[model samples]
Target: MAWGPQSTPDYRFGRSKNTQRYSAPPGVTLLGYASPEGAGDAIHHYLRDHEAQVRRGQQVVRAVQQLINQGITPDITVTHPAWGEALFLKTLLPKAHHIQYCEFYYQNQGADIDFDPEYPSSIDGHYRSLCRNATQLLSLTQTDACISPTQWQCSRYPIEYQHKIKVVHEGVNTLFLTHKHWPTKSLRCSIILLILLTWAKRHAKRLLNASTSKPLPYPSGLI
Candidate 1:
């Protein structure tokens, strides 16, 4: 069951059959403090924007509480903590195992914010980035486990938190990558050669028996 913003998924994008959303009251703005004028203003805007996150967290907490009141307790809770939805879930469900998706950890200097030479980050920009990471940092501390899609991404987080984070690929679409019904005979000779090279290397024992010294049927030059 999804607990998020109250809106129907556009079929153009696709939709989940089951979702439980908690929308903010009308007129509430999404939390954002990206572009601030000065450090002081940055802090002020950051705090103001965070208030919205707090509200969202409260909404989710209330929803979870209601679910518990109705005798529904999830065994495991998975969440993408990049936003604040996972903020207070542990508080409500102490026994549940929470696995947070650690998509990114913002670093002002060595990361994306400053990588663009033409658009160097300003002092205020750096402050805003730090503020943006506040919720994610808090969520990390609360999560029972964290999954990062790559080692490079997991490395971006603090050393202390790395122990709780595991590097695991979200996975690729095998249907698109390997499930296509392509005719091996119809494939170009070059394409066929590449596949055979991989197949021979993987199945060397089967390809190279005591009867032959060579492991592959194709010429070494082609491979």
Candidate 2:
């Protein structure tokens, strides 16, 4: 069974709303929660109420346990950020393989500078601590695989976890790239060419209409 953060109705960044619409692989079931829009508020709330975080985590764990209790033995349990930490702590799926998506790091790295404006230092610290905890837990757990979009993030993980981590570079959907060989052209290049062609056609039509508006003066014999 598939156990992970299913998509919600909201248009949250990096998460698609149609996540649950699709069917899962055989013997797999998708799980999800009604999540808030941004991490900032959630992080702030968790910091102020540590017990609340634990309670929230417990709820998630119970949900997964319920699935297992119902004879749905999922082959894998996948998770992101906070949910991943909660699942790791609960150890509910001792038999199932654990897979996590390493989305980002909260440390004071250069990349975090812009984000600091939205997530203050306090929130950043809390997030970092949580991430570190999650990383350690994942390291100890017998997870089958760790998926990451970037090689840099794959490198940030501990050497032990690194071995299990796989770098699956994100790619466009095959359906969208109908031209099998067009992958050679970057998405930006395709978009630019389309825009240029559209503009040229539009302007060419305008020019044609303008020229036709008035019969060319003179040229008596040229119809």
Candidate 3:
């Protein structure tokens, strides 16, 4: 879904590449910005995170504006709000339908903050976690709809926004997720796996993974 949108049925995505120089694929266009550090994000403060997101949103706005200037206006846009790209989008393209790729939402309790028995959530910690969600809430408010990977995750958003979220699995890797039978001796042992869904809980809420970092361009509506 990252690179599937196009007027010509081609896939294109873009973002900051390694400083060592890079090359794009045969049919892909690199329509992104090379942010200073952590895509202009910092882990030191919550306000900085929102600023970083705004910076990214500015990059996206410039890219889209350029496209419009060239007679290519997008009818639909998909973005990840964890980094703040979606914050200023609706103002620029109010007519374009925006869809946010919903993921993990941060909360003081009933979530990962207190999931660990070793570290209990504190008032300060809760406040920080809540602060982390500022950009997400703003993005959610402006977005026309949302899509999450699972029902449980989709339910993480505020009750008023739940109606706009849709459950759409990106699909699992059958090669690693296929069912298999284990011997009785092997079953005796316990296996605990920890999966990090989004960077909200990590990096002080300044998400910097490929999913959030790379903002691709699409040609038109829901294509």
Best by lDDT: 3
| Ranking of predictions according to lDDT | 3, 1, 2
- Tens-place lDDT per residue, model 2, 82-101, is 33333443266666666667
Give candidate 3 misplaced runs (Cα > 4 Å).
1-6, 9-13, 18-28, 36-44, 173-195, 199-223
Candidate 3 Cα deviation (angstroms), residue 84: 1.3
**Tens digit of lDDT per residue, candidate 1, span 1-223?**
2332334211110011212133434643222122222234444775654555665566666656665686656556667676666788888878778888888787888665675464577999789878877878778888899888888789988898999999987666566767455555733343223323222454456443522545445343233
True-structure RMSD for candidate 3: 11.5
lDDT of all predictions: 0.61, 0.49, 0.67
Global fold similarity of model 1 (TM-score): 0.59
- Give the clash count for each candidate: 0, 3, 0
What C-alpha lDDT, on a 0 to 100 scale, does residue 25 get in candidate 2? 52
- Candidates sorted on TM-score, descending: 3, 1, 2
How well does candidate 3 score on lDDT at residue 180? 64
lDDT of 3 by residue, 1-223 (tens): 1233455333233455632266666775556555624433445565666667777777667766776696665666678868766777788878878889888788777776776554677887888888888889989999998999988888888899899999998766667765663343543334433355654456433333433455434322111
